[model samples]
Target: MTSVSIPRRMKGVQIKNFGDAEVLQYKTDLPVGVPGHGEVLVKNEFIGINYVDVYWRRGMMGIPPNGIIGREAEGTVVSTGAGDVNSLKVGDRVVWLAMGGYAEYTIVPASLAYPVPADIKPGVAAAALLQGLFAMSLSHKIVQVKEGNWALVHAAAGGVGLWLCQLLKALGAKTIGTASTAEKMKLAVENGADYVINYEEEKDLVKTIEEVTGGYGVDVVYDGIGKDQTQNNVNVVAKHGTIVTYGAASGFPAPISHATLTAKNIRFVGPAESALMRNIGGGFEKWCAKLFDTIANDKINVVIHDTYSLSEIVRAHKDLEARKTTGKVLAKP
Candidate 1:
């Protein structure tokens, strides 16, 4: 590792009291701690904004108050602690998902840091890590979408949805996506969706999607929008098909009846990204390598809805919660 300048203090967003975006506090006096053994210090250049970050800000998730709040970020490594951990070196450009990413600097375990390719911008790197991995696992592993197969993606303009749609296209599968508005539907189409349904204006969404698929239901349905979409997804899914419901954006799906599944021969599955990564067989390194190649080669592109400076962190959360943004939002410090 080469020598680098050190700093003693930096700015970070502190969660003093969790309630909403208003509760996020920006502080310039946060201490920049030295990296501990097996960890490296990253000067965060871009912090990825995700709904999970909203969960933390809304107090929906249990996390300590007065701590930095962010999950995914891309940055330059400035230093490393003792021990040869994960073959990390100073000056390496990297992506990481450690906590405290909404800061000038984040200290992450070397095991958690992955070097980014030269051509991948910090915005793309930050957006691709969490959502990209989820899309890869859901499209390629969980669903095993083959050529000519069909999949339905709800919230197709969403962070994960857009990426998933692109990956499905790369695999030669078609996507029938449902978006809330005409603009969003257009965005979905631009992101590789073969068919788009304006769910907000359309009645009988399931019937519409079925009509698109020529009366045969889709092979798989990615339901990020829950609640009322449950029955729609079930009715629109083909026999022996799978439903991958990963999020409850509108709210959890209403309790399901087992008879419904049995009658349609449907299989409902939802796996956490952490657990699914373990069962991916090839490990995170290989999965990431393939995913990065896809993005670099233009097989999949990160659709950034908006970008904010570190000072506008609160507005970032507000934009996401109000559904005013599509795809991914990024925060640059």
Candidate 2:
């Protein structure tokens, strides 16, 4: 276990009010705290910007009234606190999904740190951690996709959706993905989508899905777009098929009518981050380690579209909210 001197102060991005990207402020020379018990101090190289970060920035998800926002980053461990965390030490190159990752330095629980492979860049690792882990966990553990089964992923060319396509393919399930543009549709197909639906072009999403599945419909639909796709899910899911609603990117809650499910004998599962965090007793850290292993072995590939400096975070947020960028967007401090 090598030791390194930790920085006393660092630069960071802070959100003082919930509103637009204008609220994000750059603070230089903020005090950097040492790792407490069972913690490791990370010198961040790159941080992943997610749509949820935008939601947090806008007060949509009920974050603290004024909070530091970010969920994933990759960096090197500079120090460790007093504890008995196994297989982790200073100088380890690691990626994690702990909150407060937008800073130049962050204190992460040793349990949450997982080493990045030599072949994987810090930017790529940062982009992969949260979305890849979520997709892998949902497809493998939550939905339990089986061989020859059909799975539908909404926003399939976006961060988590692209990863879900790969994971479902690896699990032997046939994948169908929905995107808004032709470029995104092509990207989804390149990423292992057996069928790609351009929802903007195809108003009849259910009909296209049914035709692709030979009128039997799919076994599962990973509905990340929420409200916009919820009603159509019933028309596309086979009898006894499961519909997992994980995100609400459509900016509204999905409307559900009891008769729809009752008539089709369908089951709906909600895979919220809180529920997933509860299901994995060892917590997100352990789950991230498993995700890292999969990436190292080429079982999953993380897609990153662009990287911006901390000063350019506002522009990054705008691009993300406008849906102009595909795959993961990242920030380097």
Candidate 3:
């Protein structure tokens, strides 16, 4: 591969102030710095738009003033810093979950970069890297789901939820997924969900869960929709089962009753990427490599709902926030 001089300036979508999607604006002359020690500069080709980005845009999760937005992207290494970061080199195609992947060029620590599999498309890598690893970490490390156990995945049609359903099935667990629409329900079923509930129509989510489990409650509930689904998740868990609350997409906070938890013997687990990384010692990149292998071997299927150009990022965010998108959304640079 031929090495090219890193550009002095790059384009990025900057959010100067917290507001709606319209607040995001294109900045074409942003400084493009060289990779420092133990860092690599990536020339991004595709970036993922997740629900978390929406939170940042809406100021639900405060960002440092003048912070660059976005978390996951796929690109090629344009330059590398000094030290023992030998795995990556200029021209290498890679994917990483970094702080500011919305830009055309961004610097990431060597630890965060992982090689993209030959079989995976750049857009697929961007779409799946962060969410796939999150799902894998939750299922294998956090919940430790075993064979034949039943798991309930909330927001099963969303990016991470869809991946969770597939990963749970691969681990030999029966998955019951919940989506908001019929189209999403169908997608979940096609993606390995044994049972799917359209929460919009099925007001009694707990009853539907019981019916799917043959009167026995699920062994684990991956609640990403938060508030609306959290309590019901706790209620539907079998004795000694675990309830993992990973996301809050329902615009409300999940309420927990201490008395109810004590009576049910249910274990409540919160899987945060930062916390998991701290506990595991090696951080998320190690888990990301394992998931990339799964994707390469066809052990898991990543669902990408749509792709848009970088200029259309606001529209992309609008669709995602509106729940109009079923799976992952990608923005290509």
Candidate 4:
């Protein structure tokens, strides 16, 4: 490793007992962890704030007490432990998908870290990697989206939602996106949603989608809003279409009987993170490469809702939970 000064301690946020944002105790004296074998230590420049972070903080994701939280970050590889790091070297700009990113530095498994392209901004890479890869998986792996397919994307103005809209459009699929507010609906449309529905104003979601699809329901329904929208997904998806319940922004959806899926001959996908992670070792590297190419070629737009200081993480959580953010939320440490 090239010579570079690394601090003994770093600033970070940890939860003593998960409950709310208040439990996130930020401190300047947290120990900077050393990279073990097959690990590389990153000096994070930008950290992505995801709803999954909220789940972890709220005790909904089964995190142990007194642990740091955060899943993804972009930074420079400062040092490497004793193992092959997949060609990673000191000073390489990289983005990693790993836990404990709400800190000045993070120890990431070398396999989970991908080098960032020179033209892509670190913050943009941070904002795009995890969500963009997930959206790509949904588009290409979860359901083979064909041209002319009609897709319904819930929370279409959000980080992953915006990505879904653009990816679907790129695949020649028409999209109907739902948002809670008029502004968000407009953003979704601007991001390539063929039709935008303000769910807050639309009384009958099923009827609205049916009318939009002209009696034939959407070819696929991406329901990230979870509990509040899962049932509506079944009503809006076309026969043999897929319904992907990918997140729990509104809380996990209630259990649905297999008969419910059999009734319509529809496919239901509730992707487990563990199963998703099965691909992370190699699949993510490929996805990130493709995702960045799309972004660089102007096929996808990365929208940042707001960037907050690491100290303002509480406010960040509050705003995200309140649905005040329209796109990706990021933090600088």
For all predicted structures, in order, the TM-scores are 0.95, 0.92, 0.94, 0.97
Model 4 segments more than 4 A misplaced:
64-66, 280-282
TM-score of decoy 1: 0.95
What order do candidates take by TM-score, descending? 4, 1, 3, 2
RMSD for each of the candidates: 1.7, 2.1, 1.9, 1.4
List, residue by residue over 1-333, the lDDT tens digit for candidate 3: 567877798888888888888988878888898788999999999998888887787787778334678887999999899886657889999887767877899888878788888888768899887788788888988889999999999889999988998988888999999888899999998888999988889978888888879899999999877788766887799998999987778855466777878897888887776556545636666676677788888887788898888888888988988899987999886
Give the per-residue lDDT digits (tens) of candidate 2, residues 115-215.
Answer: 88787755888988778877877887777899999999999999989999998888889999999899999999988999998998897889888888889
Model 3 error, position 271 (Å): 1.3
TM-score-wise, the better of 1 and 4 is 4
* Colliding residue pairs in candidate 4: none
For 1-333, candidate 1 gives per-residue lDDT tens digits of: 489887898988998777878888888889988889899999998898888787777676678434787887998899898886688888999998667888999988887788999988657999888889988889878889999988999989989989988888889998998888888899999989999988888978877877888989899999877785888888889999999887777877877679988998988987667566556768777877887898889878799988899899989988888878899999998
Clashes found in each candidate (C-alpha, N, C closer than 3 A): 0, 0, 0, 0
Q: Global CA lDDT of candidate 2, please?
A: 0.83
Off by over 4 Å in 3: 64-66, 278-285
Instruction: Report the error of model 2 at residue 42, Å.
Output: 0.8
Off by over 4 Å in 2: 1-5, 64-66, 281-286
Give the Å error, residue 54, model 3: 1.2
Kindly provide the TM-score of model 2 when superposed on the true structure, using C-alpha atoms. 0.92
Pairs that collide, model 3: none
lDDT of each: 0.85, 0.83, 0.84, 0.89
